[model samples]
Target chain A: MIEILDTAPLSSVQDLGRAPYLRYGVSYSGVMDRLALRAGNAMLGNAEGLACIEIQAFPCRIRFRAARDFALTGADCAATLDGVPLPPWWAKPAREGAELTIGAPRRGSRAYLAVAGGIDVPSVLGSRSTQFRGSFGGHEGRWLKAGDVLPVGAAADAAVQAPGFGAEPPQTAFPADWAPPDLQPSTTAVRVLPAGEYGLFMEESQQRFWDTAWKITGQSNRAGFRLAGQPLEFAQRIEMRSHGIVPGVVQVPPSGEPIIQLSDAHTAGGYPKIGTVIEADLWRLAQAPLGSRLRFIPVTYRDALDALRQGDAWVAALRRLAEQYRSLCNSGRTP
Target chain B: MTAEEIAQIATWLRAAGLDTLELTSPQTRLRLKLGAVAPVKELAVQPAAAVPSSLDARATGLFLPIHPWCETPLVQPGQRMEAGEVAAFLRIGPLLQPVTAPSDGIVGRCLATPGKLVGFGTKLFEFSPEGKAP
Candidate 1:
């Protein structure tokens, strides 16, 4: 069990998401940064989609009620275990009563804390993710509070190995030498694919959309990112009925500003969508700090598929390396 | 042993990825310590007041203090740190690789100049064990 000492308003439990429920008007409200959550889970030997704490607010404090190992990934929040600094994107064993404190993010946003076993929350609608709007899933379907005690799933025997046993002495908290090259966020651009409404926009608007750098506004959240840039004008005012939509759809409302739908966005919308960010690059936008500049580079459908394959390859390689390290430890050989 | 023999042993230590090497013979005993990139090898015949142990660069990058904004060095002479503590950092592109202490020790000397590029196996700091040598 782990107890929350202090936290911000949006901190909650999240897994991959509650999938295939959009037809029922339910949003797939899961982690904003899927890569970070998956990386943290992988470090602890948990399933990729296992539940973990999605910390959006900073200076959050958590206490371990039992001795267990945990991994911190995603944001570099200057985390400390009992006043000692912890390396980012690394897993360390914690003793009972150890208090972990996370400060403001140094880079990126949304840090993930995954324990050896996942966060033990009753799955709702096929997911352990908390959907704040409906208030029906994860820890009574709400954001985590200061006094809430969260149960941790039972850890596998192999997952509880001592530090410096299975893995070499980490040069940093992050697996700098082992992590895939593309896993790191690209500082400048995110790839996109044109949607149905791309041709409806004026030629200048289309050119600006591809050329202008958009600044993420403070209004952005798990719902969507409101980008600040040159307002895009349509070729002509046209009315359209509400249509089905998914996360990553870049919708432009009457104000001309583009809003990129995210994990918690509504299943349907009536606004014109100029383009949709590729699924592979959504994780990058999810971690983009507020007020950061971002550019959208158009890509072909084939390129988008190739990008996803690369991501899968990175994860597979990491798993193989981790398995080899564990085997060496079990065989009484130093890695 | 002569000073020339001691310098040769220091070069061998750098190649072997070792911090300190000690040798004993019936006639004489010698201990060689590597410090920084300079040829400042310390040859000790017996345990002295300062038993310096060298710390090597774990990765190739520009060496920086723990805090990039801070001007003061992360670890200084006479300061004590626990094993596994991050003593300094190596900045490779945007990533900062932490240089951790191998064992609990008191800082004796900082050899690598801050903000300078250092390759792997470059000597960075020298420290003496805090309690007994592990």
Candidate 2:
């Protein structure tokens, strides 16, 4: 068991998120960084998609009610266990009463904390993810508050060692090649594929979509990131039907400013989509700080599929390494 | 360093067959070289009588005193550390193997260079027991 000692808004229990319910108009709200949560669970030998705590606000403190193995992944939050410094993307065993303090991240925006058995919040709608909009899942369907005691599921086995270990961060494992051939150096770039209405935009707007450095504005949230830059105008206005939209769709409202729908995006929208950020690179977009400029690099569908396969490969390799480490540690050998 | 402390270090250097003794802290850096008598100014005011021992690396890899994400060093001079606490990490390709303290002690000087490749059993730091000033 773990108790929240101090917390800020937007910190909640989240898994990989619910699925097949978008037709009912439910937003698929979940953890912003899926790979980070998956890697954390792999380290603790937990099954894939187990719920973990997603911390967006800084300076949160948690007290371990019992000794348990846990891992911290994603943003380097400069976490400390009872004043002992913990490296980023590290796993360690916390003694009973150990206090874990998470500070402001120096790099990424979100951090994932996965315990041995995962956070035991009730699974709602076939998922443990918190749908804040629906108010129906995860720790009373709201952000965690001070003095909240969260229950942990029973661990699968006691094979994990106390000395602890770490896994390679995905950024380092698979370096992002952000060299946009036609554009100047941008803050961070994610590959994008042309969407249904890409050809309908004006020639200049289409060129500018790939050329301009779009700045994320203050209005950005989990639902979507509102970008401010050169307004992307269509060749001619036409009435369009509302279509199903998922996370990563870069929809251009009539105002010409584009909004990249994210985890909490509405199930359907009528806005024209010029492009969609590939699923493999959503984590990059999620970690982009507000006010930072982003450039989208065009990629083919084949490239996007290859990128997805590579991402899955990395996660599988890390899980295998973790299993090897656990067995070696249990046998009194250090890997 | 006091005269008595200098003499004690000199005796240890001779007994251990070492040529030099150097120590560093947040506020001071001191070096004692054999066959060269340099005027000793105020350096680290540590417990002179305490004998310092070496903390060796348990694996072969690149050494990092501070984490890649944070600017601060993990273990610094004058900081007390518990036994089994991580003092540094050895980065072997993508894996990070921890270098932990063998016993409770106060840190003295980091003997290994940050980002330099080191082999197993390499002396990484100089430390003494909790009450000892090394």
Candidate 3:
């Protein structure tokens, strides 16, 4: 078991998501950065969908009740294990009562902590993800608070064999040219495919949507990110019924500012969608700090699918590498 | 200067992808680079027989002084290291192998270039016994 010593609001348990329940008005409430969680799990030889602590706030502290192996990924938060500094994207064994402190991140916003085995929370509706609106999944389906003791699943025998190891971060492994170029310092460019309602937008609005860099407003969370940019106007107003929406839908309400639905966004909405950020690029957007500017670069469906494959390949490679390293450490020791 | 320190400087220079390094001070002028056959003043090359104890790479792979996501080097000069502790990593394609310390000692100098491919048994670091000067 691991106990939360200190944590911020919105930090909670998340998996790949409660993906199957979207039809029942349930948001796909899960980690904002899927790659970070997957990378951390891979380091510990855990399953891809195992629950991990998604730390959205800074200066969080966790104490292990027993000896355990854990991996810290995603943000470069200057994490220290029992007063000894640990490298980012690193996994190591911790003795019982060891405290892991995570400071404010210098790069991304959210960090993921994955332990050997995984965070053992009772799965609700086929997933351990926290659905805050329904408040049914995860640890009582609410944000993780101080003094909460979280159970850990049994670790696989191969886990932690090569503890002091790390994998390359995706951004570094993939390189800048692998994704759309950032137009300015601290401004990210994400790939977007025009949505069904793209034609309804005025020609000038469409141009502005592609050209202008939108700043993420403070009113952002797991639900969605409200952006500040040139108002995008529709060619004509038409009444329409609420339709099902998924994460990454860039919806434009009457106010004209685009809002990208995210991990915990409502499953259905009536706002006109100008475009959808590709599934593979959502993690990058999720990691974008508040007030950072974002630009949309249009891509084709084929390109979007390719990017998804690239991400999956990266995770698979890390898992395979970890397993191989464990074998080397076990057999290659020279007395 | 110690032979290990000179070797370490060579590794650092090569790791930075440079071909030459020259240092100038009031007391001495030193120039070191790949394929240099001459010894310089104040930086005499020690006899090969006087080489210090070292950590050698167990597997042939690309050497990494620091993990890709980390800001600090895995092992720094003068840091105390325990036997079997990971001092660096060797990456072979997607696989990574830990390069561990052979004995409890003070880290002396890095003998391998970071990001460069190294062969098995290549000297990776200079490690001096606890009571001895590195």
Query: Individual DockQ of the candidates?
Result: 0.05, 0.15, 0.16
Q: Estimate the overall C-alpha local distance difference test score of candidate 3.
A: 0.82
Model 2, A250-279: lDDT tens digits are 999999999999998899999999999999
Report the C-alpha lDDT of model 1 over A63-119, residue by residue, as the tens digit: 999998887877767888899776566577889999999999877788888887899
What TM-score does candidate 1 get on C-alpha atoms?
Answer: 0.74
Give the CAPRI rating of model 3.
Answer: incorrect
Candidate 1 local lDDT, residue B68 = 50
> Stretches of candidate 1 above 4 Å error?
A160-188, A326-335, B1-79, B86-102, B107-127, B131-134
For residue A295, model 2's alpha carbon misses the true position, in angstroms, by 1.3
Itemize residue pairs with steric clashes in candidate 2: none
Query: lDDT for every model?
Result: 0.74, 0.81, 0.82
Candidate 3, A199-222: lDDT as tens digits? 999999999999889999999999
| TM-scores, each model vs. reference | 0.74, 0.80, 0.84
Candidates sorted on TM-score, descending: 3, 2, 1
Candidate 1 chain A, poorest ten consecutive residues by summed lDDT: A164-173
> Could you tell me the TM-score of chain B in model 2?
0.59
lDDT winner: 3
- Clashes in candidate 3: how many? 0
Error of model 2, residue A181, in angstroms: 8.6
